[model samples]
Target: MNSTLTVSWRSVQLLRILVSGIFLVAGLNHLIEIEKTVSRIEAAQFKGFAAIFGNLELLVILSGIAMLIAGFSFMIGFKTRWAAIVLLAILIPISITIQVGQITTLGPLFKNIAIAGGLLFFILNDIKTIKKQKL
Candidate 1:
């Protein structure tokens, strides 16, 4: 491939690493700081959302596991689209529960939105690539 294409490809990989790193750290935080995470969730705008799962602590743990697995998968470019979808699924509710409604959380809310956009990149890019491959 040409230099520009090679650079572009490397940049894409770098972006994937950076994006997945957020989740990897967050997943570790969720597990390492379970009580803190739970406390924050409890303090969030959407208390009822956590209650829906019936066990807040368990939900946190499961979410952590999901994030860790999906994040690593995304970082390695394994099932990239599926990993992004999984991360996106986890992100939406968490973002809504924690960052929505509170004016103080505007930055975090937008940050999550930007992260969602990144994940969407993988999802859409893979779709296009897969279509091309099938031709």
Candidate 2:
């Protein structure tokens, strides 16, 4: 008697699209509001981390490009695990550098953590399909 609840593939696709939404919007924000993103990074409590890369603008541009690419890949469900890995790679440090310090930012911090958990769901499971595989 199999009893585990099963999700429809359409629902899984919706999850993928929803999970990628933040990254897609954020990537556009980074490109469209480059100055805004930079100034926020500049004012971060651990701002000195920028010194490690030297050119803050260049770093922001690269990250924005990466986010756009990874987010697209994630939404389309192509190479989903790799997309999750790429997103997680960029997300963890950005979360620590900006969102970890301020009480006002706590909501966003937990949001990033939740995003990581979503990505991890892909990372830990072979999610190509919703149906069970034959042994």
Candidate 3:
């Protein structure tokens, strides 16, 4: 490979690390501040379906755990496409439910959209890599 390609690859790796680190810390924060997270979920009025399987708190905790798993998988480049998909799935609902229609939350809503876009790009790139490997 060309030196320029090598540099580009390293830069991409660093970008991946930076993106994945955000998720890791967010996941850890959810776990560490479970009560606060659950309170936020409740404050957001996430009750209906979330209450079906016991309480909204449990669902929030489960989502946090999923976030942690997906974050780690993405960071280590293990099943990266699947990890990206998982993160996208998690982000979409949270974005809609928690980050929408508030002046204070507009930033978070846009941030979630950007993250979802990145995850989608990651998924497409992984598919292209797989095709190349098979060729």
Candidate 4:
């Protein structure tokens, strides 16, 4: 590849790492605050399953694991696009439900949108590569 292309690739990989690292840190912290986290979820009026959400210690653990794997893939630029898409899929809805309408805080809402945009960048760029591979 040309030098310009190589630099562009490296920049994309760095962006992916930065985005995924945020998810990894947040997910790991969730483990330490499962009860409080669940309470917050409950407070958000997530609906129809308050008790189930309160007991989501296991799910919190799994989410942390997913974030770590996704973060590593992003950092290494291996399946980077797939990992970003997965991260966005898992985060966006939860962000909207918990942070957007409920919180109404500028920081949280904008952060979510920014992360979503980052994942979209990865996905769209990679889709072009994927299409080439398919031909």
Candidate 5:
């Protein structure tokens, strides 16, 4: 058993924690400014199915809460795959409605896409780990 290998593994875990920390901060910010966030979502003109839930603001609020839950779960490494999936689900609509189009929004659009890619990478890595364990 190489001590260096053990150190490298620990370093990887630390990086994962750091990555999850970003989501934790984002989630907390959404929760702290929930009313403002919901207002912004409404301002974004999110219509259609979102309206079916009675009030769009409530749906937006719920989505923000979901993000917070997913972020917390990811930070704690609890059902990380499911957490990533939930985050991905939340990101898709946001990327489509808020981040897409407009030259001014392009940067955030790409950033969200990159974040989704990171989540996908985590998911694939988990699948690989499960497969290895079964073999």
Candidate 6:
């Protein structure tokens, strides 16, 4: 392999690790504090339909699982396009409905936004790969 190609691969690998680590930690943390997270969700005065989701923890768990799976796929560059799409589908709503309104207490909503952006990048990058795989 050319030196430039090796460097590019290394860069992608590092990005994958960073993205995957963030999702894994966030998911594991949610699972660990499922009750607390649910309570917080209940307290939020959301103006969207998500507030009607009574079993908030279930949603959180499902989203977390999606993130975990997507993150892993991203790290390995395996079916990354689909994984990124699923990850975005799960994350975008939470960011728009939940995190955006709580920025004062949440300090910053950039993390989720950054994740969403990263996932999009991965999806675009994997487009050719996905097509090659007939996915």
* Candidate 3 structure, TM-score to reference: 0.77
Clashing pairs in 3: none
Backbone clashes under 3 angstroms, per model? 0, 0, 0, 0, 0, 0
- Report every candidate's CA lDDT: 0.85, 0.85, 0.71, 0.68, 0.65, 0.69
Off by over 4 Å in 4: 1-7, 47-55, 127-135
- Model 5: per-residue Cα lDDT over 1-135, one tens digit each: 633211244443454566666666766766677777666656554434344555655656667688778877876768888988888887877666555533465788788887887788667664324321211
TM-score of 5: 0.70
Cα shift from native, residue 107, model 3 (Å) = 1.0
Scored against the true structure, residue 4 in model 2 reaches a CA lDDT of 54
- Candidate with top TM-score is 2
Q: In candidate 3, how many Å is residue 27 off?
A: 1.3
TM-score of each candidate structure, all chains considered together: 0.85, 0.86, 0.77, 0.73, 0.70, 0.74
Lowest lDDT 10-residue stretch of candidate 5? 126-135
Question: Which pairs of residues have clashing backbones in candidate 5?
Answer: none
* Clashes, model 4: 0
Residues forming the 10-long window of minimal summed lDDT in candidate 2: 126-135
Per-candidate RMSD, Å: 5.8, 4.1, 5.9, 6.4, 6.6, 6.4
